[model samples]
Target: MPLAGPVALLAVPLGLVAFRGCSTCWVIGPTQTISSGRLERTCANGVCTLMKAGAAASPAATP
Candidate 1:
């Protein structure tokens, strides 16, 4: 019983490192990206969607 106690303590960190390999196997969450050509854009989550100071792209579209 005394010998088993020391082994269990050492096994904890080893078990945690071993388990990390399989932890990222599942695609449980979404990976999203959004980009824009505008220069005044603000970025968040590795992407920029909103432009700054209302300075949008020139040449307004007409239909």
Candidate 2:
């Protein structure tokens, strides 16, 4: 019984710190997705970029 109490105390702090580290390591919000004929758009981590489809049937690139 006494062992459990001390073990839990140590585990709680370690778990909390570990969780805090992970919380900052993840990309949080500003995520979006858009789909068009031959192009797809993905926005994440405050940055947006384009993804093109290489299939021969895909639509041509647009300016």
Candidate 3:
């Protein structure tokens, strides 16, 4: 008897629900280049935030 089969059946629907909930909260727009680097626009709950490309490009090295 394999438990993975039953587990996956129950988990797939739950995963879809989680993804849909996340998508509703934030919406990301295309990236734009500036003098420094690039930037991404993110809108969440009707408020927008700018994300710098350089920072995201090398996240692991930053403190």
Residue pairs whose backbone atoms clash in candidate 3 = none
TM-scores, one per candidate:
0.30, 0.28, 0.29
Ranking by TM-score, best first?
1, 3, 2
The sequence of per-residue lDDT tens digits that candidate 2 reaches over residues 1-63 is 989998998897778777776543443431222333567566666978677755334454699
List model 3 lDDT by residue over 1-63, tens digit each. Answer: 599999999997788788775543343322112233566676666978778754543333456
Please, what are the lDDT tens digits per residue for candidate 1 over residues 18-59? 777544343332222122333355665696665545675556
Whichever of 1 and 3 has more TM-score, that candidate is 1
- Candidate 3 residues lying further than 4 Å off, grouped into runs, are 21-63
Cα displacement (angstroms), candidate 2, residue 40, comes to 49
lDDT of candidate model 2 versus the reference: 0.61
lDDT of each: 0.58, 0.61, 0.60
Candidate 2: TM-score?
0.28
The whole-model C-alpha lDDT of candidate 3 against the native structure comes to 0.60
| For model 3, the run of ten residues with the poorest summed lDDT | 27-36
